[model samples]
Target: MTIDEQTVDKIAHLARLELGAQEKQDMIADMNKILGFMDKLNEVDTTGVEPLIYMTDEPNTLREDVIKQEITTAEALSNAPDHDGSHFLVAKVIK
Candidate 1:
């Protein structure tokens, strides 16, 4: 389907865009060209072609998660400007 001025206006409004007269016309033309390209792509033969999901067949390799204590609670709280013996103190933000 071809893009018209009305469609361009609607798209611009949805995207919170403020288009000038020339810009709106340009958008309509660009959108029409994109649609035309999509229509051309539809004419291609793909009778038994499989959709590509990934570029490589190799499985993803990830390191296993290990739990280890890197620092004690006292060590973590040492540099705090404001703390209530065990926890950091901050001004109340929410009403």
Candidate 2:
């Protein structure tokens, strides 16, 4: 497919972009080049190629989930610069 100035203008507007005349012309040429490249790619034959999901052959390596030491509430709140005994305190945000 060929890209024209009108198409470039419409695309720029949709993208919320302000393009000058030179930039619009450049975009039109660039888009046409990309479309031409895609068209060339379409001419390639891939009759029995399997779609690739993963790039590597290695399987997922994960460690077993295990619980470790758990700290008490008082221990957790000990280092807080501002806290209301149970929870950390912060400045009010909502109006």
Candidate 3:
């Protein structure tokens, strides 16, 4: 499709692009060239081409989730400078 100068100016306005009269004309020509290339690509034959999902053979590599042994309260609190029974105490996080 042929893109007119008015259409190009409208597009520039929508995209927030600042262009002079000559630049607008140039941009319209470039946009039409791109559209022409796309139209030419439409004539090519692609009867049975497989869609690419991934580049590598290994698509997914997820480790199995498992629960293991944990640490004791005293062991965890040993290094803490402040604690109260089962909770770790510190300066106020917010006013």
Candidate 4:
């Protein structure tokens, strides 16, 4: 699979990118080179290789989540500029 000028144009349009003529040409060349390298990688022998999930084989240790402190709703609303006893009030932003 090779990238052409038309393919690069379509890709640019999909990505909402505005490329100059030279940039477009460069993209085509770069994309074709990437595909060529991928094709070469596909020719390598890997019949008995295991897929790598991580770089090392160490178990991840996670600590339990515990609430250290708690506060009342009134305490939380104390510093608000505007509130309605239970909820905060703000200017209407959407029509």
Regions more than 4 Å wrong, model 1: 66-95
Q: Write the per-residue lDDT of candidate 3 for residues 1-95, one digit (tens) a residue.
A: 88998888889889999999889889988999999999999888877977778988886989998887588898899889999978899999799
| TM-scores for candidates 1 onward, in order | 0.66, 0.62, 0.54, 0.66
Per residue, candidate 2 scores C-alpha lDDT tens digits across 1-95 of 69998888889989999999899888988999999999999998978998889999899999999988699778989999899899988889998
Window of ten residues with lowest summed lDDT in model 1? 80-89
Residue pairs in steric clash, candidate 4?
Answer: none
Q: Could you give candidate 4's per-residue lDDT for residues 1-95 as a string of tens digits? A: 88888999899999999999999988988998899999999999999999999988998889999987598879989999999999999999999
Per-residue lDDT tens digits for candidate 1, residues 1-95, read: 98999999899999999999999999998999999999999999998999989888999889999999999878888998888878989889999
RMSD of 4: 4.9
Please report the TM-score between candidate 4 and the true structure.
Answer: 0.66
True lDDT of residue 43, candidate 4: 100
| Cα lDDT listed for each candidate | 0.92, 0.90, 0.89, 0.92
Candidate 3: regions farther than 4 A off:
53-95
RMSD of each: 5.4, 5.9, 10.3, 4.9
Is 3 or 4 the stronger prediction by lDDT? 4
Candidate 2 Cα outliers beyond 4 Å, as residue runs? 62-95
